[model samples]
Target: AQTVTQSQPEMSVQEAETVTLSCTYDTSENNYYLFWYKQPPSRQMILVIRQEAYKQQNATENRFSVNFQKAAKSFSLKISDSQLGDTAMYFCAFRRGGGSNYKLTFGKGTLLTVNP
Candidate 1:
């Protein structure tokens, strides 16, 4: 069984600044995938960025990047040049593909507020 943890329940950041959200997961599987998902007030989950466990280089998508420490099992999300639209509940999820282990285990989530 795997579990995800987000130490920060809430975070506030100013527009154009950067904010890092903490996340650590527990799993014995060597091959897996980490994901950061954002859900705005509309309640739709959007994929922010994803990282493959085997990849040495961290995954980045435009302004969103992840610090993936495979040994520590920590995958944190860093939002650069933050915008008000980035305000939402961010969830850290994990899923190991192949076979029947294809279910997503998500963290409790961190509520991000971007202030102007």
Candidate 2:
């Protein structure tokens, strides 16, 4: 079983500023994937970034990056130069690497408000 947790239910950041959203997970599986998904007001799940459990390096995509600490079971997202378009519900997710079950367990989500 795997569970993701976002301690901050809501967070606000100023435009062009940087913000880090915290996420933690508990999983028994050794091989897995961790991801940060953004769902805007339009309700589309966009893959922000992903980190494989076996990879030592963190995953980054453009202005979005993740700090993956496997030992601590922590995977936090850092948004550099936050924009108004970045305002959305951010969800932390987990998926086991193998097996037929492709289920993605997601967190409740954190509402990020990018203020001008």
Candidate 3:
């Protein structure tokens, strides 16, 4: 039971341009792990990129990137050049593939407002 779906509750970008935030997930196990968390405004919880479900090459960080679509389980997050500290509240996470209280199963957020 791994579910993550961020249908953009709020999003804005202008400082530089480029923004794509949309995700969908519902797993029934096949090795799982996908995350993209960034909560600013003093809520601190940052780790904006991670994907490994047998890895099909889709997980980058320098401006953040991911578009892992393992058979329609979509996972998307692409923010490039957009600065302004990347105003945050972007969470689309999931965890399951092992053990050890791998908690994390979120996605009801997408409040990224970066405008300068």
lDDT of 1 by residue, 1-116 (tens): 88999999999999999999999999988889999999999999999999999999999999999999998999999999999999999999999855685899999999999999
Give me the displacement of residue 82 in model 2, in angstroms: 0.4
- Model 3 misplaced regions, further than 4 Å: 1-14, 17-32, 42-50, 59-64, 67-78, 81-85, 89-94, 104-115
Error of 3 at 88 (Å): 3.6
Residue pairs clashing in model 1 are: none
Which digits, one per residue and each the tens of the lDDT, describe model 2 over residues 24-107? Answer: 999889999999999999988999998999999999999999999999999999999999999999999999999999799999
Q: Number of clashes in every candidate structure?
A: 0, 0, 0
RMSD, each candidate, Å? 0.7, 0.5, 10.7
Better of 2 and 3 by lDDT: 2
So what's the TM-score on candidate 2?
0.98
Q: Of the candidates numbered 1 and 2, which has the greater lDDT value?
A: 2
- How do the residues 1-116 of candidate 3 rate in per-residue lDDT, one tens digit apiece? 77788988998989989999998999888888898999999998989889998999999999889999999999999999999999989998889878678888998989989999
C-alpha TM-score for every candidate: 0.98, 0.98, 0.34
| Global lDDT scores for all candidate models | 0.95, 0.96, 0.90
